[model samples]
Structure formats: C-alpha cells, structure tokens
Target: MPEEMKTLVVTGLRTQFNTAKGPVAAVRDVNLKVARGEIVGLVGESGSGKSVTGLSIMGLIDAPGEITAGAILLNGEDLRKASPKRLRELRGDRIAMIFQDPMMTLNPVLRIDTQMIEAIRVHDHKVGRQEARERCRDALGLVGIPSPEERLEAYPHEFSGGMRQRVAIAIAMLNRPDIIIADEPTTALDVTIQSQILAQMQKLCRDTGTALIWITHDLTVVAGLTDRVYVMYAGDVVEEAPVEDLLDRPIHPYTDGLIRSIPSHNAPGQPLNQIPGITPALDRMPAGCRFHPRCPRRTDACLEEIALRSFGPAREARCIHPLVEG
Candidate 1:
C-alpha cells in the first residue's frame, strides 16, 4: 500500500508494565496498517494484548505501563515521539477511541447533546454551539438513534444499554476523525443490536473514509465486519491475512483453534469445542512459541524461536507447524 493511503501505521510496538516482580511485556513486536475506509480486526482471547494495542495506538497507556519501543505513525507523523499536549490535541480531532463500556465515553450528569457539543468545540474551537449541536444530531441519526433531537436532550441515564452504546459511537463519530480504534464497542449489546451497530460502523467508514481498527476476541464478529484480520497470542500477533482467507483457510494452529471454538461450527447437542490450556502468564511465558503448550500440532521444531513468515499473497503466520501450507 502507498504511504499516502495509510492513515495509521504501527511497527515493532512493545508495551510493558513495571511490576514488583519486574517488567511484564503486555504487547510485543506488533505491526499494523490501516488504510482509509478500511476495517481491520485485531483478534485474540481476553489477555491477547488486543486492548493494549488499541490503547498504545491512542497513547492511553498510564504510568505503570509504558510503550518501550516502536513507532506509531499517523499520516506519516510519528505519534510516539509527539508531546503530551500534541497528543491531546490530536485525540478527538484526528483520532478517536470507542471503549467497550458506554459509560467510559458518557458522563451520567451531562445531557447527551451537551457532552457531544463539548467534545466538538474542545478540538475545533471555531465550531459554534448550534453547529456542534446539529453535528451531534446528525451523528446520532447516523448511528440509528430515534428522534435524535429529543434523545440529545436526555441524560445518559435515560437510555438503554444499546442506546447508550449508540450515543457513545455517535460521540466518536462527531469529529470525523481519520482513525478510530474501537475496543469491542458492541460486546455488551445483544446479538441483534451488535449486528446493527456493526453495519452502521461499516457504512460510516465507507461514507467518511475513516480507517478503523476493531479490537475483539470474538472471531464471529470480525468474520463479516473486517476486511483483514490479525490474530494475537501471548502479546504477539500470530497471524495476519485477509478476513475471508483467514476464516476459510487459517494457517496458524492458534487461529484454527479459535475458529473451531465458535459455537455455530459444532452440532447443537455436542460439547462446544475449546482451545486446550489457558494463556501463559507474561512473566512465566514459555521460552519458544508462546502457544506451544496448547497447540495440538506442536513438534520439536516449535521449541525454537519463531518469526512471522510470509505465505501466499498478504498472509503471514508465526509458527513452525502451521495447519496449512501456502
């Protein structure tokens, strides 16, 4: 991809947290590229560093945790090297993040319109209050909220869970940012609401040409929502491929296990499939392949250090014993 089309490029990212025992590496050697109007899925289990990657990109890692290495480039500007003040300026204007919990984005005491208008004026002081309110109404409508004008006047407590999530999404879209990192924004909603939000998000990206990195552990969610998929395990990305290709012909053992575990893939009465063994603790992680202990295809060669090797077009996997050969 040309550098001009790439809105967000992350390379060799390593984020660690300083603990009483020592530094725990929560993210390692992570590389991602997102182009305008593209939706990329960052998939993994609960502790797969998916959220950390999103936070790292947004420069949200707090004191105990620090980004130790690598570059985060936004339209060719290195964000990792940017000052705190610059980061704050860019956050709601050029880049935005939608957290899992709607409460994270909404203030209970404030009216929806007030909060959204404040968000807009904070970054672009030139926007008049009435103009910002109009933008907020449009955003709410775009997310499929009903009677956006009245909804805007309501407080955060007035809406249901799904409606609150939609309002949160509306706030994220208020600025028309170049990049949006959504950390499982629809995870808490029902399946039907989740589907609706996913469709709206894709449409918003298409209409506005915003690049989105969707962070989620549910493979089913990304199977249809994302264009490309990256699978992470034990702080490392284990596989990268186009969404269809990855779901249809997964190369890494870990990727295959994730697909197999999806409930729809099994018979109704059969015990749901599951990946064996829990992810290893960061400090006590296995020396070689972090997934070897749980991988059914592991061999002696897997005991050696592995690197992400390229396969067929736009595919890569970090494994010595991939389930499929390119």
Candidate 2:
C-alpha cells in the first residue's frame, strides 16, 4: 500500500446465523477495503446483509449471529483476532457506529450531557468534569445542535425526531473515531434535516480524515454522500466503483435496476421503474448466481458461480454479462 493509503481490509468475510433448520449465510465471502478518509457506501435492499456487514466490522454481532470467517483489518491490524478487552477499548474510541434508530445508542433515562460526558471520559479519563462537559458541548455544536449547554441538560425524548438523530450523530463524533460506520443514520429525518446532517458529516470527515462506511438502500443518498459505492445483493457484492462511474455506467444488471428505480429523474407523470422480486432468504439462496432469478440480462451462464473480476481501475463487478460501452 502507498503511504497515503491507510486501508481497512476485509477478506472472505462470512456471517452465518445458526437456526433450527440450518446455517443461514447472511453475508458470504464479502471483501472490501476502505482507505483513510474515504467514504464508501454500502447499498442494498432490506435483509441484504448490509447492516450485518457493518455490525461484523464493528464486532457487535451477537450469538446466534456470528462472523464465522473473515479478517477485519484496520490500518493493517487484524481486529478479528483482537481480545474482548482490546475491542472494548477500540469501540467508541477508535471505531464508532451510528445506528438508524437514535434510541439504539442513546439512553432515554440519561440527560444528553451525562451520556456525552461519559463517552468523553471513557477515552480521556484524565480530563476533569468541567473540561469533559465543555468537550461534550463542543461536540454538540459540531453537529449543529443549538444552545448546546441547554440541550445537554434535556432528555433524549425532549428533542424532535431529527434533533434526536443529530444528537446521536454528535455522540458518535464525541470521540472523533478514525472509522465511523453510519447505518442509515438519516433515514428517519426530513429532507432538510437529512441534507444538513449529510453536509455536516461530509465536512467533518474531510476535515478530520475520518473513514466512513455509510450503509443505506437509497442510491440517491449514496450518490450525494459517498466517494465510492458498493452494491450488494443476496449477501454478495455485485458491483463496486467510483460514485460517478457506478451511477453513470453501472456494469451489473442489478446496479442498473437500482439506478433506474430512483424516482428523481422520472418525468412529471411517468412511473418510476421498480425492480421486482424481494431478496432471497438466506437459507433459500439460488443455485449459482444468487441474482440470476431477478436479473434482466441473466443467461444460462449466469446460473454458474461468477466471481468478482476487475472491470476498470479500482472497479469490479461479479456479473457474467456486464454492461460495456461499444
């Protein structure tokens, strides 16, 4: 790797759920690399293992759902083999995750100041209470919270939905973690708030050189927020490329369908093109190419297992019949 490339490498990542029927492969043979200060978008439909992949990276997967095989490397260090104590030290200090639901990270019973102060103290125990309180207030200001001192004394429920989400984002930023895995942190907010939050996050990441993994089902969101995009389906990555390249010249059929499904480009009265068929259940994955059943350009060869191959400089696709310009 080059001096500028501080890569977070993930190879052969496989997460399986132990069910009564059999093992359910939620994520299979997934490989990805997020370099320093790079924002990588992981886009997929519901139950497509996007969130599971993020959780696995953060070492938050519970029993019954386990990362069966994989190497999660952060700046060349393998996090998978790290001890629980080491992982605990890393979480919220070196790696933080902002979930879709603000409540998931926020304690409803505690005031915002209490939660944020505790977070600051966890990483910087030598700081006095007043200093921690000031740091908490500054973190809140960084996320665009108005009247930070007053807001800190309020409960989580006191804030509006969008405000609560912003506060959650503020908490994630309190530690200035090197990597922040945001799993649709703005999905619940209105358009205005979403845009504001996205802008703030982008600016913060750029200024601080924080690598981000933003997982969402919205192509539009990814287009606006990420430097690159990775499309996943049936627990496998179907396409990966620069954001502009992936959006403008998507190689995989699934990627094309997703681009076409976005309603923003449709005419005043034209119906948006919607990709039919739900993602296959984990235990019921199709024989060869998991996406063949739903692909428009699928052929008999698509019924054979197709591994991801290089398509361009820093771009890859797993489709046998990838689209190419004549």
Candidate 3:
C-alpha cells in the first residue's frame, strides 16, 4: 500500500457573514481533508454551511462575508492568509471550483472554445491558444461530451442543462488542478444524466489524481461517489466517518435522520421520514448543541457545547449521546 498525497486540509475554519442584525456564522470550526484521487462528500441540508465552507476555501466569499478563524490549508499552505495575487494565481491553475449553475462559470455570449481556452491561458500564458483549444476539446471528451470539436464552437445556451454542467466541469479540469470544490454540480440534472456525470467524474479524478470535495445534500450520491463523508448541521459538522462505516452505522442523530430521509429508504407508497425541525438560523443558532432542538437522542448533556469527539480511529461525532449501534 502507498500513501496518498494530501491535496487540501481544512482546520477549525469559521466563516461568518454580516446581516442587518449582526454577524451570522455560516461555517463553524470545520475540519476536513482530501488526498489525491479521493472524493469526500460534504453532506447537509441547504443552510448547513457546506457551500459556504467551499466558497471560503476557494477565496470566493464576497463582501459582508469573511473567514474569521481557522485555516484552509492547500498542501500545508494557509489560504486564509494568502494574498490576493497569490490566490488568483492558484484559483484556476492549482484549484478550481465548479459552481452549482453552469451559468455561474460560463459566459452567456462567449463560445465554449473561447471560454475554456482563455481559462487555460490565463493560468499559464505560455500555453498557446491552439494548444489550449486542443486540451479543451480533450477535456470535454473526457467528461463524456460528444462531438467535442463542434461543441467547442457552440454557446452555453445551445446545450441542455446536463451538457452545460459537463462543460463547466470540463473547464474546471482544464488545468488538471490539484483540487476541485464542486457545489452540487449535478443536482439539476436527471438521475440518468447525474449517474453518467458521476461515473465520469470518478474516473477523471482517479486518472488525474485530483482531490474532490463534493458539497451536496444527497445521501445517495455520497453512497455512490465518496470514500469519506462529513455530515453537517447548523453550520457545524455533526459526524465524520468512512463512507461504508458511516452508512452502516450513523453515529450522530442528525446523520441518522438524513439517512432515513433518503428517497430509497421510503416504502413504495409511504411517506419518508423527515428531520423534525428546520436548521437553526445562523443568528438564532441554539446554544450548546446546535442540533439539540431536533435531535431525538439529545440529552441534558447536550445543553453544554459538545466538542467533536472520536468514536473510533477514523470516526468522529459531535453528539454526547452518539448512536454507536447499527
């Protein structure tokens, strides 16, 4: 067996945003890591801070939002303290992000070839347009897009939703980046399309040694695509474990709830189990255990803030009364 190269490591990362009332914590004390050729799933509901964590790592958090604590280390380099110039230099070349909507990455008017070629050239000026365009075509082909040459001359509007997303992914891989933060890139696609994309993504990362952090709310996706899983609730990670171990036995109540809510778990005509309450608002986050209000296993001990504690060598949970049994 060989050791995998660490590509991204996050420690105690806290990102907050300013609202009219006050600062709202979007990501709190998050720690995550991904090594070359590995896919890690960051799973949670919509307001669970998974996407914010991704944005923070990519240095894409806008005004009124900022990283207040912790470190985002890219192969031991701290991203929080990195300069604007340095961050820009790393963005497309070393690290790339595939946004939820392809439109967020693609220009409405520009040809696909124009956009992708420029993405490559901007990072390394030495790569000529012809060379970059060839790479762009190859990238598109790698993602299962057909007629790569003709597609390069097409505009974003010409493609279907799934195809557009495949293009966005192709551009992200243009530089053969060390890491990619994918923000629900397949959520809008049909399941058939989603599966195709997932297979291609897995193959791409394995072949190229790109580490991936897939931020999504879908448990089934995690089951199929990730090696490890992090379950977040109310801006904090409630559980972290190897995918098979976590799936076999979810330690945190929130994680258990999420697993139960997956569509596959429902009876043919029965309603699915829903988590009891909404994720607490950032400003209105509950004291002590953020998930206490909705957790079935919450106890008086949950009234005090619980630090993430390990259950086994590779498994950790934030709940004091963690569910250790299957």
Candidate 4:
C-alpha cells in the first residue's frame, strides 16, 4: 500500500464494444493497483469483463472493443496516451503478457530459438548471437523446460500442451520485465503441471521483483497465489482487499456469493450454494446497482446507483446493503 512500492496504477478504465445492437460497455469504472513484486488476482465468472480489463491494460483491444475512458499508468507513465511506436517499444521489453493460449504468443512455423532470440535482440541489439542463444537457453531452463537446447530446434507443435505453455511463459520472463499480465495461463493444464507453473511464477516474481496481474475465474487458484484480490462483476470492481481479509471476511454480497459457491467451503452432504441468473448483457445493463436482482440482501435502497464505499483500511465494496456488518 505504500506509494513508493506501487508499480502499476490503473484508474477509471472504460472499454466498450460496438455492436449492431448498440455500444456494449464491457468494462466500466475499474480501478486497481499492483505493487512492486506483488501479484494481484482479478477473479470473476466468464462474462464478468476480467479478460477485457487485462486486454485494455495491454492495449490489445481491436476496433470493435475500444478503451473509451481511463488511465493506464505503468511506473508513472500514462500508457493510454502513448503513441503506437512508443507502445510497441515498451510492450515486450518492459511489460510482457502470457496469454491463455500459447499460440497467441508463439508462431507454429518458427523455431523456439528464433522467436526467443529475436525477443532478446529487439531489446538488446548489442548482445551477440551466441550470448543471445545462451540467454534463450537460460530462459527456457528457468521455466523448467528439460533439454531446452534441443527443444529450441523443435517447432511449437512438437511440444506437449504443458510444455508449450512453459515455453510461452519463458518467453514472457526472458526480458525480466517490470510487470507481467498472465490471463489464465494455467486454465487448461493438469493439476500437477498447474502447481509447478504457479510455483515457478511465484518464485520468479519474488526473485525478479516483477509485478503481476493474474486474471482468472478460479477463486481457488487466486487464494493460494495472490497477495491481493479484486472481485469484478458486470464490468465493475465490486470489491478489493488483501487476500486473507477478502477470503476470511468478504464485505460485498457478490463476493460472499462467490466464496459460498466454492465446493471446498460447503459442508459435507450439504447442497452447494449457487448464485442464480446470468451476468447482465452489457448493452442492456440494469439501471441501478448491477447486482440487485440476484442479491439475497437486496432492498428498495438497492434501486439507486451505488459507488464503491470504503469499508476499512485498504478494503472497499460497492453495495447498498453490504453483507458485512460495520
């Protein structure tokens, strides 16, 4: 929470999609901060706009989805106003991203060595070919890839699913960037591989002092891997708090419902709690509080627009009838 320790600051991010029906606000009024060497988990369901928020920060959104309003600041520099050339220069060198699919970051036709060495060359052209190749091998080994030297000669298709993911992650960490945005990088892997990758990522972040934004729908993964957590609902951050505080005592109804829905939290033989109803369509968003319809504690007060209110030190929630008693 200290000002000096903060590495990335994002505020008032609004991203909308232009569709035939009209403009759909996929992300709205979202604000979050990641401290140096800290990992923050952005958790929500499939259509909660978590991925859109990450893409917006990375400046990867295309014509249909545009970031309309917001400031994305990386180490005090405003990324929103940066020119295309500036963004390109800063992207892979200072800020790297590990996408959900390895293919997004890897080219099937190119050998691993070519892609990785090119990445290093782009940032440090003075480094010789031999040194760059050595760095590429080191990067591969850092991600737990075995026989990295020989593997470098193989194409992406030759590696297994988990191996491909490891290669992609290695590429992201090659530059030792200040921040890494990982969007469900482990969602498709088996549990053992997931655990290994998560541990490696955590160790890398701690050792290299890299800030990380891990976007995922799995609360279980977030509980173990993140220093802090932010719950997104209907394109807005409904709650934000330290990991322990949010898990132990969530302040918002939406947060409570998500925690309750986790199978591990239910009593043996008891029916699992499920939040009914789907996320509201962005174009047809509700007039008042976006969550009012499904909230068990909803009342007439919920019929008015609500903004996030401070709950305690470093904790905030947006709800007319908060689940937690003050």
Per-candidate Cα lDDT values, in order, are 0.92, 0.89, 0.90, 0.91
lDDT by residue for model 1 (1-326), tens: 78666999899999999999999999999999998889999998878899999999999999899999999999999999999999999998899999999999999999998899999999988999999899999999999999999988999999999999899888888889999999999888999999999999999999999989999998888988999999999999999999999999999989998898888998998998899889998889898899999989988888888999998888999988887887
Predicted candidate 3 versus true structure: per-residue lDDT over 1-326, tens digit per residue: 12224788888999999889989999999998788888999999879999999999999999899889998888778888999999998998899999889999999999999999889988899988889889999999999989999999999999999999999999899899999999999998898999999998999999999989999999889999999999998899989999998998989988888888887888977999998878777888888999999988777888898999888877899988878942
Tens digits of per-residue lDDT, candidate 4, 152-205, equal: 899999999999999999999988899999999999999999999999999999
Off by over 4 Å in 2: 1-4
Give residue 175's lDDT in candidate 3 (0 to 100). 92
In what order do the candidates fall by lDDT, top score first? 1, 4, 3, 2
Predictions: Cα RMSD each: 1.1, 1.5, 1.8, 1.1
Q: TM-score per candidate, in order?
A: 0.97, 0.96, 0.96, 0.97
Better of 3 and 4 by lDDT: 4
In Å, residue 33's CA in model 2 sits off its true spot by 1.1
The reply for model 1, stretches above 4 Å from the true place, is: none
Judge candidate 1 at residue 180 and give its lDDT. 93
Better of 2 and 3 by lDDT: 3
